[model samples]
Target: GKTQNIYALNYNDKDNDIKISLGLLDTKHNWSGWISPVNGKGTKSDTPNKRWNFNIQKSVDLTNKDEMVFGLQYTKDSMHKTEHNLVNGELNKQSKGNTRSYGLYIQNDHKFDNKWSILSGIRYDNWKVYDSWMQLDKDKSKTIYYPARSDSSFSPKIALQYKIDDESNLFTSWGKAFAAPTLQKMFSGSASSASYTEANPNLNPQTVKTVEIGYKKKFGESTILGVTYYHNDINDLLYTRKTGLGKITYTVNGSTYTKDKQRVENAGTATTNGIELDLNHKINDQWSMFANYMYQQSKIDKCSTNGAAEGKIMTYVPKHVFNLGVDYSAGKWNSELVGSYQSKMYAQDNNSDTAKGVYTAYDPYFVVDFNLTYSMDKNSSISFAVNNLFDKEYYSYNLCEGRNYMLTVDYNF
Candidate 1:
C-alpha cells in the first residue's frame, strides 16, 4: 500500500522570456507479506520519502533561425525505511539505504532553413549515498556498512530533422545515456534457488550509445503513420553474475578477500537492434483506432568472465510485441478496447531456459482490456473497465495479473 502527496507551482513572465517552478513531493509505503507458505509468519516494512526542488528556465532567440535554452535546477531528497520479521512476536531492524542527487542541463536548437533543423543538449549529474547499514537477527556480529561516496556524470545528445515535404518528414538522432546504480541495488541482498546476491557499492554507471532513424507521414486529417529503426551499444551494463564461489572480491577489516557469492557487476557488452511501426486513423468523429508493433533483437556480445557466453540473447527481450486499440464515442457514451501481445522471453542470462520456476523461459501470451464510460453531465462521468477480458494465464518471470474489474467516478472542476 502507498500514499503520496505532490504539489507544484509555476510562474511565467513572457516579457522577460523566463519561467520558474517549485515543487514538493512526499510519499509513504507499507508492505506486509508471508515469508514462506510453510509457516503462518510474516514480514513487514515501512518506507517514507520526501523531496523538494526549484527550477528556472530561460529562452533566448539568437536570431531568426537559431535559439538557446538555459535551465538551472536544485533538489533535495531523503528517505528512511525499516523492516521487521515476526520473531517470537517482536520486531527488529533489518536494513536501510539512503540517496541524494543534483542535476543541471542546457540545450541549443538551430534552424538552417524550412527544410532542416538541429538540436543539441548536455547535462551533468552528481549522485551520492550518505548512509547504508544492515544487521540481521541471524548474524548480529556481521553488521555491514557501505562508506559514503559520490559520483558525477556528464551526458550529451544531438538530433537532426529534415522535412521531405508538407505531408512527410525524416529524422535521425544519436545520444549518450548514463545511469547510476540505484540505492537498493547498491546495498541489498536476496536469494533465488541455489544462488544469493550481495550488494557492491563499487558498481559503476551503465553507459550506452544509441542511434535512430525515423520517418512519419500524415495523410490528410484522418491518418498518421510512422516507422523507426534503432541500435544501441551498451558498455559496463550493470548485471548479476552467477559463478562459482571465489569469483568475486570484497574488502573487510582493511583486508582484501574473495568470496563465492552472486554479486552485481559490470558484466559485459551488449547490442540491441529493433524496429517499430505505428499507425493512427480516424474513421469518423465517433470512431478511431491505433496500432503499433516492435521487433527487437538484443544480444550479449562478450562476457567478462566467459567468452563462450557471447552471442546469446539478453534476458527479457521479447523478439516481437504488438498492440492494437479502437475507440468509439457517440452521444453520451464512450468505449475502448485494447489488445496486446508479446513473444516468448527468457528470464536469465546465458540462455539457460531449463532452470525451474522464474529461471525458465516465459511462454507468450495475448491480453485484452475494455473500458466503457457514461457521462452524467459535462462535469462528471462514470467508467467501468475489465482487464484481461479473456482471463489469459501467463507469466513474465512470475504469474501475471488475472482478470480484474474496476469502476470509477470522475468529476471535473
Candidate 2:
C-alpha cells in the first residue's frame, strides 16, 4: 500500500512579471511479502519520504528585442526505510538519510533580427548529503554510518535559431550538464547467503556534454515535418562491480557465511549518437495523424573495472524505435489509436545474454493501444481505453504486462 500528499502555494505579480512558488510532499509505503521462494520466508517493510521546494523568478524586458530572466531554487529531501523478518519478528535492516540542494540560474533571449535569434543560459548548483546511517540487524547490534559529502557544478547552454521563412526554421544547440547520485545509490545495501552489496559514500557526479541540430518545415496547409540529430559524451558512468568473495560472520547466530560482495563505482565513459524524424498531418476537420521514428547507437568506449564491456552496446538502449498514432473528433465524440515498436536491446553491460524471450533478457516488441471518449455535456465526459491490444509477450528484465482495459468518468465544476 502507498499514500501520498502534496501541497503547493503560488504568488504571481502580473504588473512586474514575477512569480514565487512553494511546495511540500509527503509519501509512505508499506508492504509484506515473501522474501525467498525456496525457503518461503516472509518480511515486512515500511518507507516514508518527504520533500520541500521553493522557487522565485522574475522576467524583465530590457529592450524591444531582448528579454532577461533569473531564478533561484532550493529543495530538501528526507527518506527512511525499515524492514523486519516475519518468522522471527526481528529487525532485519534499517536505513535513513537527508539531502539538500540549492540552484541559481539566469537566461537571456535576444533577437538580432527577424530571421536570427539566440538563447543562452547558465546555472550553478550545490548538493549535500548528511545524517545517513544503516543498521544490519538489531540483535547483532551492528551499524554503519556514512560520512557527509558535498559537491557543486556549473552548467551552461546556448542555442541559435534561423527562420528560413514563417513556416520553417533551423536550430542548433550545445550544453553541459551533471547528475548527482541519489541516496539509494549511495547508502542502500542488501545481503544474502550468496551475495551482498556495500555502500560507497565517495561517489562522484556523472556529467555529459551534448550537441544537437534540427530543422522543421511545413508542407502546404496540413502537413508538417521535423528532423533532428544529436550526440552525447558521458563521463563517470556508474556501474556495479563484483569486488570479491569473502567469508562474513553473523554475530546473532554465531555462524560464518560466504558471499560475493558487489559495489557501485564510476566505471566507464560512453557515447551516443541518434537521429529522429517526426511527421504530422491533418486530414480535413475531423481527423489528424502523427508518426515518429528514432535511430540510436550507444556504446561504452572505456571501462575501468570490466574490460569485456568496452566497445559493447549500453544496456537497455534500443537501436530503433517507431510510433504512429491517429486521432478523430466529431460532434461530441473523440477517438485515438496508437502503435509503437522497439528493436532488440541488451540487458547487461557485457552483452552476453543472447537468448531472447526468456527471463532476464530483452526482446524486440510491438504494441498497440486505443482510446475513445464521449462528452456527456459541457462539464462531464466518459472514456474507455485498451492497453497492449495484441497481448504481445516480451521481457524487459521481467515479463511485460498483457492486454488490459480501463473505463473512467470525469466531471468538472
The sequence of per-residue lDDT tens digits that candidate 1 reaches over residues 355-402 is 433432387889999999999999899999999999987766667878
TM-scores for every candidate against the unseen true structure: 0.80, 0.85
User: How much RMSD separates candidate 1 from the native structure?
Assistant: 5.8
Residue pairs clashing, model 1? 245-260, 246-259, 246-260
**Tens-digit lDDT track for model 2 on 71-148?**
999999887878877778888788888889888999999999999999999999899999988886785457778788
lDDT, each prediction: 0.78, 0.84
Question: What is the Å distance of residue 232 in model 2 from its true position?
Answer: 0.6
